[model samples]
Target chain A: MGWFKRIKDGIQTTTKDKKETPEGLWHKCPTCKQMLTTEEHAENLWVCDKCEKHHRIGSVEYFHILFDNGRFKELETSLKSGDPLKFKDTKTYVVRLKQAKDKSKLTDAIRVGHGKMNDQDIIICCMDFNFIGGSMGSVVGEKISRAIDASLKKKIPLMIISKSGGARMMEAAFSLMQMAKTSAKLSLLAKAKIPYISLLTDPTTGGVTASFAMLGDVNLAEPGALIGFAGPRIVKETIGVDLPEGFQTSEFVLEHGFLDKIVKRKDLKNTISNLIKLFAN
Target chain B: MATLIEIEKPLQKLLDQLDKAEHIQNESDVDVSKTIKDLKKKLREKRKEIFENLTAWERVMVSRHPDRPYTLAYINAITGGDFIELHGDRTVKDDKAMVGGLGSIDGQSVMFIGQQKGINTKMRQYRNFGMANPEGYRKALRLMKLAEKFNIPVISLIDTPGAFPGVEAEERGQGEAIARNLMEMAQLSVPIICIIIGEGASGGALGIGIGDKVLMLENSWYSVISPENCSAILWRTWEYKEQAAESLKLTGEDMLKNKLIDGIIKEPIGGAHNDPEETFRTVKEEILKQLKKLKAIEPDKLIEKRIKKFCAMGVTK
Candidate 1:
């Protein structure tokens, strides 16, 4: 009843005509309850203008935002696990893979690109939380590992955007191995003296946090992103204490020195470009 | 209860008989002498056999035995009283869960860092049951960086249930801290040797675990998940932990066979706790030998080989 009342209040305040509102024309801000036309959402880069909420963007969108003139060559992940564990839960692993593949129209959680940031060459490996919860199995792991290899070979800065719920449990042990694999290759990146700036979006947790996402030379998180290892419910059950308010948020993590900076989504490209230039010089 | 292992029940029974016989008889009591002697011989044989045939779960039990010597004890034994402990991650208060400092093996200066468990109730609470927070790992990284600065070799003793899973740990970046260590250690420009002196559960052990040579003590295990946790997740109950240990292939011998680890350091016949002196000697010898070989390697070559070594691990079929 309370939720219904709130919804009614929101509709009453909106000036837009209900009948004329086109399905694809308007998108409501999940945080502040402001309805914006599709044009307005794109103009704001999907950021909620009223609440400053950073909406989730896919890897393709990220490539456009960071790469020069929205032009870049996409590097194929070409990695499919072959459903390695034959992992099945309520649905067979094959069925889940097929459904996710059909929905996301992507091979795996990650998308790799060799592109330019402010006309400077760089490598980008961006993850999508929509794909299998952005779980890092062998495919995602190998793709990122290969991206690191490409960066090493090219001797360029690397930036990885993370959005995930951690390792895919369906993939089981095969998923766990990726943590080590990514971390080992990341060190090779470090040894090559290449700068890596990790950009963490909402809900970066579990094995990814334990590996490359946290291994960046300069760790940056978007505002209000949920970045941590164990999620809240598990932590609450284990520690038997009320967690600190705003804990695991980007701002909170920054205060504790876990993150180097909290970069708003709007400033990410310019900031990364500046960093690459600074380091290069 | 002395916590006799289930598989040792037969041996325990014989020992109990000897205890009873010794108390009820004088030296001239001839009726039970032959029986007691035979029982003693049988107990000895049974103990030897059990030690030889211990399953992975039983070894897990031994690794966590109450009387087992902890990280500090081994450090003291290895350093021969020449050790100094450094403190703090410099950003937060010193996490006693991770203890490290400058120490030595056979008078050669080496840096030592390890997860420390409590010897008693008060200490255990203070140690957080050897589960580290983010500061613990950052503190370890700081010390590791210090070791690298001096170009000194590092010896990391791993013993943790896992990284602390508290909300605070997550909020402060426990996973990131561990991940950063794995990446940084690979390029430290100094020899890094890791030994699983106790439980090596997932990311916690691996925080400081990536090394040129990773070793494990006999009766210790290194796995992606602890047996109990693995059992709970896979079998949906902790009751199948013993079976989980078997299936996980977590023992040091298993690790050696899989090429995840370089070698398995032998504990005393029973365990490290049964004869600490012998344990200390064997551990020291193993460290010295590994250090000798590691020290001979060029820094760049060492860093290269170290990365390749870990990259080769868990290339699952």
Candidate 2:
């Protein structure tokens, strides 16, 4: 009877007077279902403390992780995609671009910047998966090409962090041409003897993977990243069979002799600097 | 899998009517020659009209027509059966999806490479429907490097649904193979010409597509993704493929206008399937013309221009 009775008249705080935990305060580990404070999760470089899963992050987080003091000079911020095909689907491509821009606060899928990683000068081009699934369009291609040119002119090492779905379907052949365009520019970079490092993150597939993402002199990848020519779904659909465990992961790719190394997020800057120094020697 | 394109269906009916009229005349004492002649003229006008204003989707259909000449057909016709089929990447099995060889085109030794779709159901299965695996692309690159060694002009005919989307393809590094080809092709010291004779989808086409000059057949489509795939992605269904095709602007003319291609090789009326011989002849002439022009340049300059041409692609602010 005492247990059933209200315990000393439950606290009289009204709903209006009570406070709620703000949204985004906590982060959930997708792999292990562990919850932790967002700050703690971010401090671990977005890797799950329990399961070590690397959560997909954007250019902002990458810049923070790699750039010295998170300070760098962003390049070609003014460039945006044109509706060359005047493409339309359920919605016009122009509208989709606008919506993606507003949501991601990015002009396009990629951001190029030059900064010192461990005090070593390097040009980094990072893809934001939030922006149209990091699809390579004209803007992405032009930006990467310019980044390569900068690396050549300045004689600095170039690094690209690929996190993409594929080429932008809306841009059509213009998107397809980006593979050739960026690869050709990398050829120029290769001729100049500038060290080129490609970092493949989660979900690098399709045209992006088949071009500059795989053209690096040294191809590095994050652990457990999905790195392949075709998406797992497409591959499964095409092959009509269940894939093996760890298929197309960075580990699998490394084992298959496609990747040079797998570096942890915390060691990325140091690993890159050391590789650049080695190339310099 | 409809043999006749929607726009060409009326023309097919007209031709059928003409055939009936001719049969009547050939039979006992029935004079239907005048009707046959009038029907022939009408068929000509109908064909012209159908081809002239073909929707982009119809062009896609034409590009995939089963009767269209595959890569080997063009190579054999151009070389007068003088093609010596090259086999194997030397590192892996010879991929049937990609066919390459040394051939003589008008007394000039040339290296020919292309994605070879099958001519029949069985062959299509054998060829994997023209979808090249990593080994296929590697074989292509090997042939191109061989052409570079011998100072022969390299001609690549592109026709593929895409690079093969299989687990083994990824395991073998499809992307790296294509990427290496692009980089190596950009600097290869031989005249490389790429012609999209059929489907040119994504990295598969570009794997062997980099060249001093890139041309596309009139009905063929070259795009980042096929219209059906694009529609599936954007509209969440394949039913909107026609709209997707129109939106993609992936036809040869669109490519020319976009400066993604050097020129569009006009197809025979209806499509390349309607007159494979004429298609082969036109492609041969275009390839020879482009090769002559490209060969005039020094190797170093050719490489430089090739890089420059691709570098100049992609419209950005």
Candidate 3:
């Protein structure tokens, strides 16, 4: 059987059984409601071919897409969150961290890797939203700050893919401190004139929007990314007003000159490499 | 927001008695003028006492008082009506929430940038309640850069609960805008001073907050997070915002103790709202004094020392 047909059959069987199987062989696009075979979905770089909707992706997929031949040395970004507050609302923070680690197979939301893109050395940190909404805590902060150091030491270009809800509520003030700490570290890269490209993805909000994610030398975003300091619901509650159509979408921000460009998933690598070459002098 | 002259529950009964006594005096048939004079004196003294002993949460409420003087009031006072309001981010339309301009203080040209909370409901709507969009930060940065080009000091008056958390603000890169300001302000050749005139909550305040010396009003609160929001995450109810306020150590005294701010500016006995003119004069004098010391240093040393100063923050004293 062809890979597409086989995967589609697996999805059909899972639905027929209705047992909630671990294997998800076919997926539906949230935008256009188009069912796509999982094989075709991965091959399309996780974007919906029918609707061209950029699907939310994790750091690992991004590494494959951006790194030349999907090859790179992943940075050791495993810093403990330290559960500074011993905070618990519904569940203990440590328990939540363990659950997140189990589900995402990531030590934390961010993954840093040093690799070649179009024969140019670069450091890239991608944030994964699947891990507790990619809420930045001490681990996320320290890892990304170290990534900045890595770029400065190696004298390579840097890129950060942002996907977060905001500061991790569990971490409280510790998470908020990251805003200042990360911004302070980014200035070292700025003083060195090292090029840093910021690529924002779905649901970038809160403290992340106010820090290193926004400090890129060249700021870029994936098409239709929800990038803002506050989400729409919280804003409506705070301001008691309905937002204009397309208020915080990539196109909306680009029109207002907040971003340099909105690059397609397919074009992200080439676009970044071209910019890197421009700054190669 | 405040309902002008609205007192907290603790002082509400006293104010009500004062009001009744005044009304009796105004009724010519009553002839209670002596009682009215005593009530007025009691009200004044009571206001001073209550303000002096306010809880941190009450202070938070006062900081956002609708009738309180905002950044524009202080800037206009300092400039002595010579404030020429500038506009636009060049790339985006001007943000009404963050206002900046070329203004003169005692004949010395300086760039004054600040968050503006409008006075009335209509004006508040127009200013987005002093919460800035990303464009606002960019506008502030553009004006500061202009000031830098002309060799002028930059002063930022911070008074935002936080940056606008609207989806549009995030979409437009609010974090990037604020982060850029922090980085650029550190390297700015000209002296920079920041005054937290009201609420200095989280990254919103920090967006334009980096400076050689950071100051706060006696009642102003500066924290990593706002009390209500902190309460929501911690205790699951904003009812605990008072507790959160106390725990966060956000008052002016906490800021001074933590070394987060250079000093605290004294407000009127009943807060800036009771006497804005006196508050403005004091702020103006404080600015002029800080400017005198700041201007004496060379540009490079000013930048270097400014960076070092921020780097030393958060150290345990």
Candidate 4:
């Protein structure tokens, strides 16, 4: 309810009645409830405008936000999931899966489509956390794997926007196995000689951290994403100790030699396109 | 009273055994060599225990044993036909640590990419003790590309002590190379089966560890970081490696329990190298079985399933 309230508040505060500007003039932090100025938000990568909290952007939205208008063509979009295990937890797993499917409004947690960030052909897989907490389930895994295959086939670079709460729990062992499955797939992508860039958003944890999210060609994180495997609560519980200030956040990860760079959301497209152009195939 | 007696049956048996162990019998004053022999027999019986009973440090040792068999050894054992070793990344010199070649596994055309460690000093230097440099990872990437082009199922054997940490490796970009492998491997349309024959240590093992079916030798281990490294971090001393190992959960048993690996491949008694032929046969059978299962899935489903598998790792209770 609080999250929905925040979204509603953001929608209510926006004064543009004619049309939403391309890439917009100003925005609010997706996490903390704060108003942001256009210039300040631009400087911070359209992040929070005030609180510097990173927000989820869809593959198409990411393309638009990063590149010029209507530049991306979706690739490997048809991969879907049929319940393999017939798994059940709490209620029938399939029932919950359907609910997540309806709520997320996406076939899977990830969307893999190719587009130009800046006149450069790059395959993008954007993990939407709003979709079942952006858990990597079978369909999400397959889509990402297919995206990599497409990138290799086309001989282009890949840019993944990661915002996950790790692997999907309802899927049981079937879900946990994705860590190895995706990692293996990524290994093949490497063999094909393609560069994979990871753009870590908020709360990339669990199996996602164990596999591809951590294994980026150029590991970049948003300003405030928590990028560790064991969340702060779990880690504190496990070790019987309090975490340092900002333990799993992107800034902490960057400081600990885990991340490559911390790119503001505004500069994401320019930075990625420049990198792609620089490493032109 | 009868119910109480029935409940105490198991406890009485345990108490009797403990009493026998604690008490001095008439044989205690007998021949010293005989006494020594009895104690040795007891110790031998203790060593025979498996899986759950093992201490964390013992698991680490088991994971790192030279005679535990490695990726190269398994590949050699599994492939009955002729093999041709591939070399070079085309962008750099060949890395001996990682061996990839054209091979046939039970008549199925395949590309083999695996980390090879050494049992001795000369071999360790030659194989970098299974610690791959950037070039090693590069070679793997090249091989995978070739395999994808040919639509060959890539059989990757993972056994490494993490990526090479030398200055030269860093200069060439060790992290970047590992990351590159992770990125590229995800997109490969062709099937991959990664088997951890020995130590699956961190990023080094992960460079070639993505797979449709990821299997581990029963005694092998997989983790994000080694016990020593974890110990250095948590306790500030390598001596706390045992403690670190327990905390890190790096054992094959733990991995299988945690669902980090698909299943465990049974090994020969006294480890793989003790009975290399038997170890080879078991590995081959298991691999072939897994390959057959994976081959049935459609390419789209395969990729999707693989992605889901990764996405869902460590998400369970």
Identify the candidate with maximal DockQ.
2
The sequence of per-residue lDDT tens digits that candidate 4 reaches over residues A101-219 is 79868767888767666677778888888777888777777677678778778888887788887656545344545655666677766666688888888778756775678787788
Question: What DockQ results for candidate 3?
Answer: 0.25
Q: What is the lDDT of candidate 3?
A: 0.83
Candidate 2 lDDT, B1-317, residue by residue in tens:
33675667787778778877888898859787889889978877888888889888988988888888999999999999999999999987989999999999899999999999998899999999999999999999899989889899999999999999998898899999999999889989999989998999888999999988898988899988888988888999999999989888888888889999998888877678877899989988988888788888999999988888888888776
Off by over 4 Å in 4: A1-281, B1-52
Q: Local error of candidate 1 at B13, Å?
A: 1.7
Screening candidate 3 with a backbone cut-off below 3 angstroms (N, C-alpha, C), the clashing residue pairs are A206-A229, A209-B175, A210-B175, A214-B176, A227-B170, A227-B171, A228-B170, A228-B171, A229-B170, A230-B165
Give the least accurate 10-residue stretch of model 4 chain A, judged by summed lDDT.
Answer: A1-10
lDDT of 1 at B252: 82
lDDT by candidate, in order shown: 0.83, 0.91, 0.83, 0.70
Across residues A5-121, which tens digit of lDDT does each residue of candidate 3 receive? Answer: 443333555546777635788989999999888989999999999989999999889999999999999896546667644556557778998999998888888889999998899
Alpha-carbon DockQ of candidate 2: 0.80
Please give, for residues A1-281, the per-residue lDDT of candidate 1 as tens digits.
46544433445645565566457998899889998898899878889999999998898788878898888888865567565445443456678878899999998899899988888999999998888889887778778888988899889889989999887665544466578778889877886799999988998988898998888888999999988887776688797888778978888878877788998878989998998899988
Best model number under TM-score = 2
What are the runs in model 1 whose C-alpha is more than 4 Å off? A1-44, A82-103, A168-181, B5-11, B21-41, B48-59, B149-151, B167-173, B230-248, B268-271, B274-278, B314-317
Q: For model 1, how does the per-residue alpha-carbon lDDT over B150-178 read when each residue is reduced to its tens digit?
A: 98899999999889999768767788788
Give the range of the ten consecutive residues with the poorest summed lDDT in model 3 chain A: A4-13
Q: Rank order by DockQ, top first? A: 2, 1, 3, 4
Docking class of 1: acceptable
Q: What is the C-alpha local distance difference test score of candidate 1? A: 0.83
* RMSD of each candidate relative to the true structure: 5.3, 2.8, 6.1, 12.9
lDDT of 3 by residue, B143-218 (tens): 9999999999999999988888775675567767888887888788899999999999888888898888889999
Model 2, position B58: C-alpha lDDT score: 87
